[model samples]
Each structure stands twice: as C-alpha cells, then as structure tokens.
Target: MKYISGIIAILLLSVFAACEDETKTCDSTLLSDLGMNFKKDTLQGFLVKDTIWPKVTLYAIGNDSVLINRQPRSSAFMPLDPLHDTCRFYLQLDSIAIPDTLTFRYKRVPSFVSPGCGFATFFSLDTVITTYNTIDSIHINNREVNSSNDTHISLYFIY
Candidate 1:
C-alpha cells in the first residue's frame, strides 16, 4: 500500500509539472508588414483609387513563395526583410508583357514590445524605385510601417 501511494503521488506531481505554463508565442499580427494599394487614373480628371488587378502575380525577388498569386487583388501586405536594408519584388500584371520591378529602400528599426512578444522590426521608407511597365508612378502614402492596416505605398497604373 505504501509503494502504491508513493507511485500515485509521483504520477500526480508529474501531471502538475506538465500543466505549468511555459509556452510563449509571438502574436502574428505584430509582424512588420508593408501594405500596398493600387490606383488608376481615370480619363475623367480624377484618380480611381483601389483599382483591382484582374490578374496579378507578386512575389519577393529572392523568395520562392508567391505573396499574391494570379488573382484579382486591389491591395497586398508583404513582409519586409528584417536583416536587409532593401527589399525587391516582382509585380506582373496580366496586360503587361514585361514585369515591373519594385525596389524599396528602408531602415529597419527593432522595437521591444514585451517579454512574451520578443521584438518587432519596424521600417521607415527612405525611397522607392520601380520600373515603369504597367505602373506609371509610385507614391509613398505613409513613410512609417509598423504592422498597421494602413497603406504605405500607393501604386498608380498607367491609363
């Protein structure tokens, strides 16, 4: 009976130890992501904002995974390289034969949120360079990108 009681106590202690909370997870929403919005110039002397791309494919230059596949998209959220000072992306529109290259120059600022949330990299856009193909020009809507639902870059399509 003494041995059985000792075994039961050990099992209970093991169970309690396993139940301790030591899991730390970083929130996905806190990632440093850049938002891009698309717009087109209307012949009616006004810019039509949030213009959708009927067939668009976008991906980072070095990355194999595609961010925006061949689908209709009006906006896109892409993560910047935390270790690099610049990031490049390939944007291909359906109507355009040559894909446009977008290069973004930025400064990565590492910010500490909390103990559980380690660190987040924020970006300050210095400048943007793009090859004119389907895109006529680019505008920096917001210079600061801090994982918000705000448009950081506005891409104007050639009308």
Candidate 2:
C-alpha cells in the first residue's frame, strides 16, 4: 500500500509541473506569429430625437473570384435616452479567408426632432484570418462620421 501511494503522488506532481511549464510557453512571438494583438476602440454616436438606421457590408477578393455579401451579423444601437447615460454596439466578422483582401462599406441614416444637440460617434471593423502554422498578418480599419440631419455613407478596406 505504501509503495502504491508513493507512485500516485509522483504521477500527480509530474502532471502539475507539466501544466506550469505550458503556461510560460505563451510568448509574444507566438502571439505575433498568430497575428493576434490587443484590439483598439471604435465608437460612433448620433444625437436625434427619432430613429436611426445603420448598415454594413463586407466583400472578399480571393484568388479565384470576387465575393460581395452582407456580414450576416447583428449590431447594437444606443438611442441615448436621458435615463441611460451611454449606449453600446458590438460588431464582428462572419467569416474570413486566407491570402485575401477585404473591403467594407457602411451607411447611416439619422432623424432629429428638436435638433437641440448633434450626435457624436466612433466605430471600428476588424477581421482575423488563421492558418495551420501561424497567422500571416493582422489588418485593421476604422472610420468615423457625423451627420446631424442628412444621410451619410463611408467606405474603407483592410488587407
């Protein structure tokens, strides 16, 4: 019984040591190679008494063909009501392919009531592509626009 207990304790210690070593392996080089980085902030705001409209589209240019489609994802819009101090929105890419460039197009429509104050906003679009060995590169694009009483459109790209 004593011998068996000792063997069990030794096995447990080995497993714990292996786990500790694994944690240290997450280095910056690995992150960079995988094209991973800390994400920046992008936000946009509009001040209007009525409703607002926003839309986004992403296109991918592959070696074979050109793909143009909607992101098929949901986004949040904050009305900036007096009760709520701030609003939040979340945007994400549906899918991404390797060795390809992506183009983004955005449009917004705003309506105002009393027009006491205009709206202020900022926003960002990011997509990450991964491979079997490592990430080739990370590309990020951002844009901001303010329209008090008219419609607006914005376009940009990331490669």
TM-score of each candidate structure, all chains considered together: 0.76, 0.18
Judged by whole-model lDDT over C-alpha atoms, candidate 2 comes out at 0.28
Misplaced by over 4 Å in model 1 are: 1-28, 95-97, 114-116
1-159 per-residue lDDT for model 1 (tens digits): 769999999999999888755446544457678899888877643747568888889899999999888888888888888889999999987745478999999999998755567678999999899999778878898989886668998888766
What lDDT, from 0 to 1, does candidate 1 have?
0.83
lDDT of each: 0.83, 0.28
Q: Pick the candidate with the highest TM-score.
A: 1
Best by lDDT: 1
Per-residue lDDT tens digits of candidate 2, residues 1-159? 769999999999998987665433432221000011212222322221221112222222222322223333222221221222222222223333322222333333242322233333222222322321112223332222222221122111122
TM-score (C-alpha) between model 1 and the true structure: 0.76
* Superposed model 2: Cα runs more than 4 Å off: 1-78, 97-147, 150-157
Q: What lDDT score goes with residue 111 in model 2?
A: 27
